[model samples]
Target: MKKLVLSSLIGLCGLSLSAQNVLIGEGSLLRGRGYCEPSISINPRNPDNIVAGAVLDAVFYSTDGGESWIADTMVSSFGVWGDPVLITDTAGHHYYLHLSDPTGENWSSEEILDRIVIQKSTDGGQSWSNGTFTGMAHPKDQDKHWAIVDTSTNAIYITWTQFDDYGSENPEDESNILFSKSLDGGETWSEAIQVNTIPGNCLDNDSTTEGAVPAVGPDGTIYVSWGNRGNLYFSKSTDAGESWTEDKVIAQQPGGWDIDVPGVQRANGMPVTICDRKGRLYVNWVDDREGNYDVWVMHSDDGGENWTDPIRVNDDTGSADQFFTWMCVDPVTNILYAVFYDRRGLEGNHTHVYQARSTDQGESWTNIRITEESFRTNPLVFFGDYNHISAYGGRVRPIWTRIQGLKMGVWTSLWEESRYEGEKD
Candidate 1:
């Protein structure tokens, strides 16, 4: 693998621009337990305090605006398996959610993935509770869960995919999206309810319904979107999670959610939904509709009733692959930011991390390369599903996975919007 600094790329232009890269955790080759699929959240109350989580049971925290981090492992009675999702409430309380493995037997026991587990942290990510769970319908599997906090009421809402029998080829097995909420912090949760009208098979592929991410509108309305079959579906709850509208198709995902990228073990173009303070809803995903994988976004102003045409996010002119994309709308500034693995000017399996910023409500974008070096990946290694970005005020933190040889590590870049005020392409 070739290692090059960001400053080296900018030297040709006689300009200096760089974002500080911080490594949170690294994994060894033993049993292939390297960390990936990282999630991050910045405290709304204090931008300096941040928390992050990676696959399996790793947790990290930074108090000085992501300059340094403290890493630790998380435990729960229900068992922390994978698919880590982290979010912080308005009151600065952080929550870590993941799939459960009750018997610790992994795939050998049917008890694995019987439910979804959520643990709360009051004092940042230093410590966590044993965890409380929802969607505990045994004999079934719950996976691909994501959550968001309603700043108005401090309530937590989550959405995920449930399977009758995971990885089952039987035609009788099915898959659906489920919704749940916690009104009184993490102490209790509402009963999980079915939200998707059409069900998919249990194959966990393009036909399987997945990627139900929830976003809150300015008027307190809840909106969710997912990819099923070859279309992206949308649904909303005007009265919170108690009720939901019938599922509606918003866009066509030509290649579906399951995507093919070289040097990646497995990848998906799952939709990530977010809303700005002005009630403008945005859904971002990746697909190969143009003969190669690219990041795209669609926005709805009337709360999912109508949506704009798919807007390509990458600025490169040639065909290249961009996968594992994530987006975030700054609550204070409403500026849109997206992060993804980019192969714009590189050949073969070489990849670098890039972020796009849109200040005019997705009308146009400016791309910035945030990674200090590019790394090559091997398709045999198990690279996790997704990467995450969180922005509060002007502070932006993008977390991603990097593979060097046989070792994998989780990293974040200390990025602030003001740093590149006069930067040019």
Candidate 2:
């Protein structure tokens, strides 16, 4: 058989592709997502278990891995953001999802009403129970989302930003991160604690807002990062949010026009992170450092003592076409695989999914465009392994939204295991 490379674009699908078979598609056993974009994740504990959530307020679960699907309960009273955070423990026994009201819906009455929230799903995404955190809701029209993790102590530490709409007053300061901890499931959270504020003095206050990404290392060291006042920063706590270290700059983009358009505003979405088994910390974000929003990665080898220079991850690093990126590592191989949306096609502006592999510990990569099927343009990719291997073996999947008619339909692609991790170093 001849190896064919898809060079031409499809009239309906847009990009050109050579080979591959569709796994779970929209019309397949997995219900179609025509209402709003949906997000998917495999339970960390059960390889046969998969979960996905939609904007309509329901999280779907798949017991036979991702081969088939079923709708899980919508949880009791929790709102959902664009992309919900999913995590399964090392044993794959415990599974969880962290969500909040972008519109402040399904919020608690006693608290701020429309505030941050955490939900638990121990039965592999079948059903969920609500757990309360320090009750601090967002102000009117303020969106609340969270960064949550199950730490080495078996405790769940969650963090989120609470602030007002754009163009607000500094006296209002409008933005700050709140922290909480749960020792016994989502039953109880520590006192409502404010971790750090997005320190900025924008006289314009003209469309300025940012959020934080807090991830807990295996050692229970909590690391938080966000952008504010035209800069990027990080804060840490070894004592589980009880106290914190002084804030430090991880990296910040240049100001003025560079901050506009596809700017790396912390408000874009949740920051993606991964930690090697050796306790090394890796954080990657999108910024307009190149005068256009591009993916930049910074690593802390010595547990945040210091970070390496910013390294661009997109294959088309020549342009600021990369954004909305996410990464997951194969614990067995320790290889880093990242996928992100890019707009470089000559036909028109589209968010095609591009993938890259880092073999030398984030030093070098083989960047490749994975979306050879999207034609409507703007194809987004979510890279994760159901089998949990770094070599891209087992089940390699990417979830994308396909725009059809007046509706944007949710679609997914799962390459056969034989086709997994084929690219070499």
Candidate 3:
């Protein structure tokens, strides 16, 4: 009877009295472990078919969404030193995984062009083509992030970060953002164009990296957000990577200097943007509004013309903990889900994964602790299908990675609805 009562509470949380918050299939991804970022993508043609990135020699796949997964038995190497980015573009009738794997060790392995790879999967990632994306250059700096937007005309918009024009790391030096375009669907890239041309340093220094997350909204509105200092910097490409406007200072949270915690990591960082059902632009990021490194949000109904003030999502205040975040919107219902890593119960101050939702665009938020178990790194989240709700209502899945010194691997948690039954539908 005690077991039955505990099971009832757990089922009331997310399980159907049978499933748990997240399930380990083919066992957790064993290869791409510690301090690594993993990504997931579903065949645009088939929502039931999905693929996730983990350590090489081992990645995982699921044919029935997140219900069951079959591990790739073949041994391969995916440059697992950095967080992985993923996308799927249908060529003719086949699906390809645009993946980034450092080509060789040394700096080349982390190059924006060389390390980035795209593998074709005609049989749902069971096999891949040897052809890779070339022509882009990976700067000497390892502090980088990138995004690829496939335009209707087969064009691709690529964006990444580099040291400011001077290319110096001196404290007196400045850093800026750079972007390139590919007119032939990731085949050839145009000359690099600097996006954050504003005077002073648009690039801000962090513990060890400098970069941004780029997202393209409706009508080719290219946007990128990052942390420099304690505030957040936003830039947009009105002319689609050709000409960029000045750096827009979206939000800034003052770094905490408390008695116990001197000079803490700011709350405002790692921003993400997406277009909603009515084309409204919504932006979100990890913030310390709650005193801890919780999540805060802001929105623009006029398509980025203006934005509402910041709203705090996670109630965790002042603890200074949260990482590994990604967000998506459901066009059919206009609901938004943002999944990220938190350090509520980790060893020391590590990261665990949680998710928050905004049912009414970006007005209010209700955060859910998705993973009963969280990781020490950022949790990668993506929707399997935009047309339908996620298996966990608006919450998707977290292909979460765990790190222990030099060893690492990945696990996943389905961000399903547990607050109310059937309310998500």
User: What lDDT does model 1 reach?
Assistant: 0.89
Better of 2 and 3 by TM-score: 2
Cα RMSD to the true fold for all candidates: 4.0, 7.7, 7.8
What C-alpha lDDT values do all the predictions have? 0.89, 0.53, 0.50
Put the candidates in lDDT order, highest first.
1, 2, 3
**Which stretches of model 2 miss by more than 4 angstroms?**
1-38, 72-75, 78-83, 90-113, 130-134, 137-144, 164-170, 197-209, 255-270, 377-396, 415-425
Candidate 3 lDDT (Cα, 0 to 1): 0.50
Candidate 1 vs. true structure, TM-score: 0.95
Residue-wise C-alpha lDDT for candidate 1, range 1-425, written one tens digit per residue: 12111111112133245467777778785666698999999998888999889998888888888877777888898999999999999889999999999888999998999999999999977789999999999899999999999999988999999999999999899999999999999889999999989998999999999999899987889989999999999999998888899989999998999998998989999999999999989999999888999999999888888999999888975788999999999999899999999998898999999989999888788888887668997788889889999998878999999997677888888777776664543
lDDT of 2 by residue, 1-425 (tens): 22111112122243332223222223211343332334556554455676665444545566654545554435445544333445555444333444445345443432233445556667787667664534454443333344455535567666665554324554655555567777776677787576764444223222233445566776878877765655566788888789877777666644421233332222242345567656777777666766666776778987787889978787575654565566666554667767666676633444565666676778777676666643443223221111111122344445544444444434444433333434321
Candidate 3, position 122, lDDT:
64
Question: On a 0 to 1 TM-score scale, where does candidate 2 land against the true structure?
Answer: 0.75
Of 1 and 2, the candidate ranking higher by lDDT: 1
TM-score of each prediction: 0.95, 0.75, 0.72
Query: Which residue pairs overlap in candidate 2's backbone?
Result: 13-374, 13-375, 14-375, 44-92, 45-92, 48-65, 330-390, 351-378, 351-379
> Using TM-score as the measure, what is the rank order of every candidate, best first?
1, 2, 3
Candidate 3 lDDT by residue in tens digits, 1-425: 01100000122254232224433222222433222345666555565566665433244566665666655522224333333454555442122223344554533443432333334456775665553443234443323445544434445555555443324546555555667765654555576766775433433334212345566665767777655555666777777778877777677744411111122232225566666646677666654555656566788766566878887766565465664456777544567877766666456645555666777887777666655543343223211100112222333555655443444545555444443335444
